[model samples]
Target: MAPALSDILRITSSLLVLMLLMFCMGAINLEAQVGNLAPDEVEALLEVATQLGKRGWNRNMKLCNNTKLPLKPDADNEVVCNCSFPGGTCHVVAIYLKRQDLNGSLPKAIEKLPHLKHLDLWANYLSGNIPPEWANTTLELLSIGVNRLTGKIPGYLGRITTLRSLNIQNNMFSGTVPPELGGLVNLENLTLSANYLTGELPQALTNLNGLKELRLSSNNFTGRIPDFIQRWKQLDTLEIQSGGFTGPIPSSISVLTSLTDLKISNLLGDGSDFPNLESIAGIKYLYLTWNMFTGPIPDWINERDARYGIDLSYNNFTSEAKYRETLNLFKSTWGGNYSKPVEFLIVCSE
Candidate 1:
């Protein structure tokens, strides 16, 4: 009968190529068990550890005080918090156990932990905030810094723009400062220091221009410090202390030649001095102490260059002998003959 109909069409084409190679090996073993811990993610992590062991939660202490809980990553049933190795310098790649202290809230099945990145629950006493579906995933590092986090810092976190590092510093984050965080242009490190952040200063954070480190100190920020803040030319550290900055400090900020550390101390109050700060000739650690600076302590503060460490003690400097001749010319050109003051700390002790 025509050779049994060509052997039943070559045995139905070899059982359809062995059922398409067993459906591509079961779709690559469900994409390598999608980083394991399945079974409805361990039944939603034992139903969030049976609702935090029914409140008396203490699955082995260490909840704060440099917090610990991350250490496990062999895959399988997941739940291996943080397994560091000599490899990727691991920081919670899969199950960080989101905003720990499993009290209440946040368990909408945890959006099914699709390889969480790092969700440190800042000062957690975790309450309700930031759960708009967690802006839909793909986190790198999101600290709820000093929690009690009220609303408004989450404009969907600008969609987690490949966040490098972000800390919602000392939370209770009030309105503003979310100029969409400049869409996290690969943020290097940012902390909205002491929140309650107000308007201005968030022109999308000068578009983050790849900030190196910026902390908008003790917020309530007003305007006029933005000449694009010298475009953060790889800025090393610039803290705008107790914001409400009026004007005049921008002598183009000495073109920010990789600012070492400059803190414009306690804004416009007690003798605020910013008269071009001797052009910060590569400031080493200047903190223009308590503001409202008036005149005389700036003949370049006796022409500083003594590897710099000027504090300009409590402003309105009437030059106590020109601040003791600029601390004896920074203890004689940064080395000191006055009982070894090589690293000066002139507080004017007032």
Candidate 2:
């Protein structure tokens, strides 16, 4: 009454094929799910990326490997690759790994994401050189400061014209600053202090039309301050201390009307030739210590009153009552405005 033994074998084989078909179909469905995940699914993926762990990268072969999309799909089934936050997509536009236990070099896979804009990996244990591919990407802000990165800074980074801030201070970067950095026209803030950079300050940096803060202190840089820096109208703070700088500070720097804090010391030359102090302008806290400036204190401090606080201590300035100037003075502006001079103190010992 039942099916013959031979027929049973055939039926069993057919059933096996059906099972395989279902397995293959399920795999396809999972793959397609990545491209069709709902809004909530994308948020989960972003959360995973944030937890990249002490290595700061997910290196597992199947790790979120195409199992998820950057953003939720539209009604038309098209998935978005990159969109800012609040759009509710899985797209990883920026990575904030500050003060994390993150270690090791950045993954080369980072360059594959064409829309990456911000990268903050400060205060991490990250070591090794930044990948050269970083130069080709479109980063708006790169903060790798306070890391253990070594090797010459990628000169190619100068090619990134869209960058607004570049902070790589407190690293082991050596060699001269890349003059090629002149190409970054949109640069607003650059902090390369406390490195091993040498050579003269590049005059080409004047080309950075939008530069506002330029810090190159505590390095091995030699030669005089670049006079062309006066062209950077937006520059507010200019610090160049504890270096091998020789020659007088350029008088033209006074033209940077926006300057607020200016420090120029440890010079190998005289500071008197740094222009008649009276001509200098701006609300500046000036420090000209530990130099061979031989002359009387310039009358500028006497003229500008409060806003032009200065520190010429330990220099060769001829002033009898140098200690008397330490007293703060409240001077009245012409418009019945009373302003006090915030005395800037400079201490140097032999």
Candidate 3:
């Protein structure tokens, strides 16, 4: 009682069709579970994936497995995206590509990530000028330090109102700092050291009243140190070295009550000329090396807080021994009547 050959083929075909229909239904259910990400955002992310290399983002993996979203799954530990929101919509909030040994130009399409808050590409081989389109975004932190980037800093960067910290140090940027930078009213830290930047520091920089730290050393900037620096009342550290700044240190510097560390060296001025440091009581570390400052060391320097330390090395000071005496005198205050031996460093060399 074996089944006929034609009947067997018909039964087999029906079973196969049923299995196919079940598979399709399961796929549809899976798709429904994965939440929706904006179409434009998906396209922008794909562009990044293509530019950075497809290996960094895998299409086969679940992007938002935890939340079941349509976001691209993390791949090769290179890219990261955030998709947790009220409406199941995802946003690429941060991109950290630091020290990835990445080489090539930064894609201008990066500006397309509207929700991007932090972008770090430090210690890479990235080159070329910063994209002006970046100014149109809402980035909060942009760090591209220790790279091979060149060309003048784009003025459009000033238009980015959301920026809080901008680090572009150790690059090949040339020309004067863009005056437009003053527009970053909320900037906290601005590092532009170790570059070929030149010309007078734009007076507009005084507008950054909220600035905390400013490092502009190892550049070719010339002209007198701007007196407007006193306006940066919140500054804790001010480092300006190896530049061709001339003229006397401004007396207004004493007005910076919040200053803790002041390093200004290798400038064009008489060795005797120094800033008025009497009012800056918070200063703990003062470095003024390799300057032409000659003349008697100010007695007020020793009168500073007992914890204050200074490096006046390789200067044309009147006498090293006298400077040592000043520091030792302050150290004595710590010991009181016992007058215990104390170590004070007053670096002075021929």
Candidate 4:
């Protein structure tokens, strides 16, 4: 009787082990499928396609199949998926539909793509303001530049704390920048250039200590260039040419040791000394044109590999013997004005 009982127990144990192995294999197979696309995501995608005026998306095939919906260069409609969810559920992680000329509104259904991190709609003719429903998303990068997006940028955008890059340039967005944008502490690139935006920059912008590039040119803004820019210790590029800002370029700029390209011009303020850019050895391109900077030419401009990298045109720099000597031939063309109303424009870097 004891031998019979032992045999039955061993048999039962073996069956249990076999069952466990089969379950694991099933799990592995599901994982290998890159997580089956979730039903809600598919529905949301359908809505997205409808809103974007794209008629070619086939609902029958797996959306996660990269061969069918690629995320490569120049691909008109791209959807990237992340399949790391529990139970092998896949979710859309990114969407890029650039240069499509899709005459559609910003899709409110985009909020349903919950896991989406990046959304780019560049070079499109999309109309209307950003949908408020988008504030609920956790997007990291949002690029809608070179589009026909119109209306004031919504204040609700600040609620998206996960954002790292917010580009809305080359649009028809008017009105002052909402102070709420200052809430994006993780922001690295903020491009509001080439818009009809006006009003003073909010003091709240000082909170973006991690900002690297800020371009706010060709706008209708009216205010002093804020001094709080020194707070951005990681800054590399800053462009505000014809940005409608007044006052001297803040001397505190010297504290930004990481500056590489600094372009600021058209200040509506009194004459000031040259901004101290000596500490920034990695400086590549410097453009400070159409201002009233009255002083002797600083060596920092000449210190780089800049045979033609600095554009100090229409300023009031008294003298730089070396620069004058290099451009001595061009001087004869300018009739030796010496640029008390200094005029300069350097060719773009090679």
Q: Which candidate is the best by TM-score?
A: 4
Q: Which residue pairs clash in candidate 4?
A: 313-343, 313-344, 314-342, 314-343, 339-342
Q: What is the clash count for each candidate, in the order shown?
A: 13, 1, 6, 5
TM-score of each: 0.34, 0.68, 0.75, 0.82
Better of 3 and 4 by TM-score: 4
Among residues 3 or more apart in sequence or in different chains, the pairs in candidate 2 whose N, CA or C atoms overlap within 3 Å are 70-91
Tens digit of per-residue lDDT, candidate 2, span 15-123: 9999999999998765554442234434433443453344323332222223223233121112233322342333545555577666666544556555556676777
**Pairs of residues clashing in candidate 3:** 63-73, 271-292, 271-293, 271-294, 272-293, 272-294
Query: For candidate 4, lDDT tens digit of each residue in 129-171?
Result: 9999999999998988887888998999999999999999999
| Model 1 agreement with the true structure over 230-250: per-residue lDDT tens digits | 777888777777776664566
Question: Which of the predicted structures, 2 or 3, would earn the higher TM-score when compared with the native?
Answer: 3
Off by over 4 Å in 1: 1-4, 38-117, 120-140, 145-164, 169-187, 193-232, 235-247, 250-350
Q: How close is candidate 1 to the true structure, as a TM-score?
A: 0.34
For each candidate, the alpha-carbon lDDT, in order, equals: 0.59, 0.64, 0.73, 0.80
What value does the lDDT take at residue 134 in candidate 3? 85
In candidate 1, position 156 carries an lDDT of: 75
When summed lDDT is taken over every stretch of 10 residues in candidate 3, the lowest stretch is 329-338
lDDT of 4 at 93: 85
Which of 1 and 3 is ahead in lDDT? 3
* Whole-structure CA lDDT of model 4: 0.80
Error of 3 at 318 (Å): 1.9
